[model samples]
Target: MQISRTTLAVLVVWLAAVAAWLVVAKPDMKTVQILAGEMAPATMSADGELPQRPPADADWRPLDQRVLAGWRDPYWLRWRSTAPAVQGGADRALRFSLRGASRLYWNGRPLAGNGIVGRTVAEERPGRLDIVRVLPPSAGAGTDELVVLASSQHQGLRLLSADAFAVVAPAELLYGQAMLPWLIAAFATGALAAAYLYFLAVQRGRRRRPGARLLLALCAVGLALPMVEGWRALVGYAYPWHGPRLFVLLGLHMAAAMLLPAYLARHFGLSVPMGVRIAYPATLVAVAAFMPGFDARSAAVLLLSLLASAGLLLRVQGAQEERGPILALVLAGALAMAVAHSAFLDGPYFLLLAILMGFLLLRHAAHLRALDRHNAKLREERAQLSLQLLQRGIHPHWLMNTLTCLQELIEQAPPRASRLVESLAEQFDRLRDSSTRQSVSLEDELALCRSHLDIVGLASDHPLSLQVEADDTRLSLPPGILHAQIENALTHAGTGACAQHPFRLRVRRDNDRWTLELRSARGSAPHRGRGTGTRYIEASLATAYPDGWRFVQGVDGADWCGRIELTCAS
Candidate 1:
């Protein structure tokens, strides 16, 4: 899509925000988890200290796999595993992202502690959710057992498991924690801005398009995504919040999945069956319920949504053959990116969605332009119809004048009267054919002029000739305008004067401007102010060319002259 000044400004602001955040937070990191996953529980001493020897308890279970017993006020969890190879240096550390305050022990030696861990609620102090403690250089590969004495007496969220502890370099842990909030904030800001802009556009439009609501829905989804996925980074809630956080994330995913098909259906002017809508969400919930983890549930929902939207798009591909395949490709690419990353609502995912939104905005702008053009054409047509109706009102008076001439001719000379009759008939035929039209060719108008002169000349005793000066007779002008001008000149000038010189007609073109001039020999009949014919000529020009045309008439030297100047649209 073509970016407007407002969008460019928004982009510049977003970039500035990101730059400022990077400068402030200074987090450069990677998702390199050297050691992370389920840690089996082991027995610890009554004093919340590590045992000198390994626990022989066969009841060891993955911390994340089993819910901790609620009755155990002060919990002592232990795990033993072969340490992974790492550079033995002062930079190495253990990162603990836990719900409750806790102290750690590495290989039976005191490592570090966060806040205060006690057996009772009054003795415990809440700590920062993320804690990083430097490891001694000797504790790298030599470390064998890790013990955690955690108490959930002051947890905001009642988390049951402590499986977020990981081994990493202190810099990496700090960087990851610092970078997360910035990333989430940046994307969330962008999504919110996009949603506000779309909302404003929808509100300002005189006629809302079919895709308008769909765009708003997409923006809403985009805004919700970063907020849902990155709430932890923004707010350091206790680890217990993870459960509710995952629930909210899964719910948003399912809602977005259902929203996609509906958005597509509405955008493409297709009707979605109520059954399909109901079944899709039911299916998503059913599948998500059986999923083992939040990541799996999220990925499944994304894939199902992709398939559902694609199914609808493809089913109606026959109606929108050109757009269907392209939309499918974009949807497939977006879903694939999202599914590939366990944290599906990340920066890259939103970037793809922004691109898709831009494309849709461009299409909507094009559609609006097309509608504007169509409306303009309709207005022009209505004006033409109105002009034609006005011209019809003048026909009765004109016919009476002609019949009077015919009556005079029949009594003066029956032989010439027949020719006048034919000319009158031909004039009526051409006028009937041209009346329903907006414009007629210059040649057709000239023929009409010649027919009018014939009927007048044959009826009156004066034989007249029409002097033409023009090139490119195929040019078009409002129908019957030239004919009307000729009739006006004859009726006002009193044919006795026009019998001295033939009427003059000229057509000229210069670039996009067109000029038509008609001059009649001055008659003794005094010029009368604007007549019905004059009003008719003025109205026709105003209707056809609006403000793009000028009309002027007066007696110039020895002749009466009328000039029409207009700019033709390209």
Candidate 2:
């Protein structure tokens, strides 16, 4: 029951999302409905004083279900509170909407007002549509009398008023209203920020691509949409500027429209069409500019449809990586959201961010996979290097002979013993360096090979000589292959420890191939047993030049011949 790092991270993210949802949605708080009826006007008096009771013959009507359902005009409402105002303390506030110009009163006391009410379009003034008024704690609770005077008059409007609204706990009302969008916005912002930095950190590495930077930008800007809206909800949509949120929403939406097609085009390696690249956002601007006859949301949706269509085309074009699939899913989600609204996904942030974060996670998964492969390859190469280093001790089978020869040299000939010691030290050093590198220069390899032959000559009665006939050029090849061949020749050639048989090494290159030939005077056939030398050489060749090398291990007509032919990779 060990959880992978990815799963653990996902779980932690889920927990955070849930916690944020709880805080944003305020699920535990109860909403007490403070008002739920149509409004009536107070009795008028000559002294400009309002009466406490409504006149019997006053023109009062319950907000018609049809009218309230399709409300789009100014409305005045008077509600008698059923409970004390600000029952949960001044920390609570009233939450409702009154479009155009409006004023509110509590028990004949002026509470708040936005803009000026007018009877005609020319006289009308713009005001805040959403309101949240925290009760002054100094004013004792139990005040229930509430009145709202809303006026909306414009050339495009016909109705005088629409309907009275409701009163609920500010926390409960705003939270419940905006919970889903806030959840999506918060998660998207967090995820995209992390993913953006990940790509930025690894652009020099082999994982993240350059085009993904556009996706990061898309997510970053898309995150702002729901955030702007959700913050408006959190603060009861209270703002001094008129229609600022509306303009902000349009600008962000239009930016997404522009960014979406661009990201999709770059990711799938296609050209963004002229229409989507130019006309899509252009239409949004036209609509917002013209104002009266144009439906901005509809225009925006059409532009978004262009984005979705581009994504679909990318999917059809065989761009089926994480980028393609993720783009398709997001575009499809956006379409579903447009048609189904909150039914498909609750929030705008989640709808747009779903694909962005999905793509980010896919990139993370790819990065993890690449890193694992890199680690595994490093481990395997290190193992092979250690093996090659270990092969140096294989001549220990004649260890007694070498030691006996060294003892004689030390006692009878001090000069030869010193030369042997130096050769042995140089051999170990060469082997150490060769083991650590995949390839070494021909000159260096030849030096190490001669050191091995000299060391072997000390223990054997036979003298060893080296002959290299390359065309005065230096080349690099995988180390230890030729060394391994030399070791094999010495091991199985059956040259007597005290016999005077000489060995010669020759190297020459053809037009495209390198040839290394080792000959033994005894001319023993190659060992057929499953030995380490043969396997190591074959593995190294396959790894370095899988399709361009040949290794033949057998005896020539008169000598034990082991030769390797290698062609450098193009």
The lDDT per prediction is 0.64, 0.58
- Of candidate 1, the 10-residue stretch with the lowest lDDT total is 31-40
What's the TM-score of each model vs. the native?
Answer: 0.53, 0.44
Taking all chains together, the TM-score of candidate 1 against the true structure is 0.53
For model 2 the local lDDT of residue 473 reads: 43
* lDDT by residue (tens digit), candidate 2, 44-100: 457754343445575566656345433324454666666666643544456666545
How much does candidate 2 score in TM-score?
Answer: 0.44
Question: What is the C-alpha local distance difference test score of candidate 2?
Answer: 0.58
